[model samples]
Target: MKLICYLSLGSPSLEQSKINAQNYIDAGCDVVEVDFPAKDPYLDSPYIQSRMAEALASCDDYSEYMKTIEAIKAKNPNANFIVLTYENTIREIGISDFIDFCKRNHLKDIICVGNTHPEVRKELISNDLLISTYVQYHLIPEEVEVAQNTNGFIYLQAKSGGKYHDEYKDLKSIIRHLREDVKISNPIYCGVGISTPDDVAMVKAAGADGAFVGSTVLKLQEKPTELKEKIVALKART
Candidate 1:
């Protein structure tokens, strides 16, 4: 199982964000999902929203954000990275410009947090960029179709809000359904509400190919040792 860590670029400070990325890479994260700080990150949890807000306050320039990612990549030459941003950011940067920027930076994978238009998807595919498919616990037919067609991993939301639902709780069955019923062969990665080693274990046990962890990892940015420990523990579960 892969351990994917999320980090908001320029959070706190660019230098500190670089350090955090390096720490996570050294601690055995297979992939780091770098988020472009947005003025409003509505889809994220409070922890992420706060961090992104701080990141934007520090530096909202898209070029500067890509520079930071480049620096981190230079240090960890083999480390994998996936860009995470909202559709609004894409529109703000201009889709073609965004694609060019990512290509120039060697960033091949993206997880756009809002509805991506078909034209945008077609353009991304033509540019050889992989776009992740997101599936909620509700299991709508449209979501299943998207999952079936994606070349990238399917991002399965573990939980939406503070509330709980049986379908959400039964991730194993959901995974099975996606594979058997929906005929989606893409790797399924569960995120949201995954914050601990045990949570990582649970996702792995449920047959997920990977787990995306954010808030829990971000909360320990100040304590590098603790953060490394947490990452190592989480990776061990994989």
Candidate 2:
């Protein structure tokens, strides 16, 4: 299973973000999700929003974030990297310009948590960048359509909105509906409050491609060894 670790760039500090990302990669994370700190990330829960706020307050500039990406790539040449951000960030930089920057930096995947218009999706596809969007717990017809047309994968978020247990059924149901009902074959990644190795196993067993661990890792920032162990365990479970 693909283990994607979500981290906010420049959170607490850029140096710390770099260190955390390196630790995640070393811990067996297949992908490190770099979040562009937005002023308002509505799709995120309180913990993630707080992290983004802290990151934005410390460094609002995207230049340092871009450099962080380059630095991470330099040290971990084979590590897969994806940017998770709101649409406002893309609009601010202009879509084509953003795609050019991603191409130059070798960042191929983009998970637009917000601001997913058909035109924007089309443009990103034209640039050949892998595009992903969230699939909410309460599946909507529109989201099913979006899933069918995604360039990369589908991010499945639970309804409860935070890291918790008992979401396996919900996740399984959604993936089944999308795959069996909607007949969309995109890779479905379960996120939003998934933390433990058991959680990862449950999702993967339920037909998900992987689990996106975000807030849990951030919470373990001070405990690097424990965090690494957690990531390693999650990877092992798959």
Candidate 3:
């Protein structure tokens, strides 16, 4: 099973963010989901929102952010990176330009969250960019269609934040539906509320291909040893 770690560019500090990224990769993360700081990261949890705010406050320049990512990539030559950002960010930099930027940086996977139009998704896919399809607790028909059509992995939410959907009783059932009913062969990675080794074990048991741990890893950023141990423990479950 893969372990994906989330890192906000320039969070805390550009130098420290690079350190954290290296630590996460060294600790056994298969992929790092890097987020470009946004003014309003409304979809994310409070923990992630604060990190993005910190990142923007430190450095809002896209070039600097790209340089930081480039530096990180230079250091970790074999590490996999997937870009995660809001649609507004992409709009700020034209879609074609953004695709060029990603290509130059060798980033093939992208997760453009928030109300993005289907045409935008199609354009990205047409340009050979792999974009994730999010599968929330509530399995709506539109989302199912997106999942079926996605060329990238499926991002499955592990925690519903309080909302309940009767279509699927549990994560396992949801996984089953995606596999059997939806006929989605792409990797399904479970995120949101994933923190502990137990959570990783639960996701693995639920038949997810991977687990994404973000807030918990960010919380331990100041403590490098503990953070590394935590990632090691989480990866062990997979």
Best by TM-score: 3
Lowest lDDT sum, 10 consecutive residues, model 1, at 160-169
**In model 1, where do residues sit more than 4 Å from their true spots?**
116-118, 159-169
- Arranged by lDDT, best first: 3, 1, 2
Instruction: Report the number of clashing residue pairs per model.
Output: 0, 1, 0
The C-alpha stretches of model 2 lying farther than 4 A from their native spots are 116-119, 158-170
Clashing pairs in 1: none
Alpha-carbon deviation at 45 in model 1, angstroms: 1.8
Misplaced by over 4 Å in model 3 are 116-119
Q: lDDT value for candidate 1?
A: 0.86
Rank list by TM-score: 3, 1, 2
Q: Name the better of 1 and 3 by TM-score.
A: 3
**Pairing residues by index, what is the TM-score of model 1?**
0.92
Task: Compose the digit string of candidate 1's lDDT tens values, residues 95-170.
Answer: 8989988888788888877764567767777889888998887676688788888877899987555433456457
Q: Mind sharing the TM-score for model 2?
A: 0.89
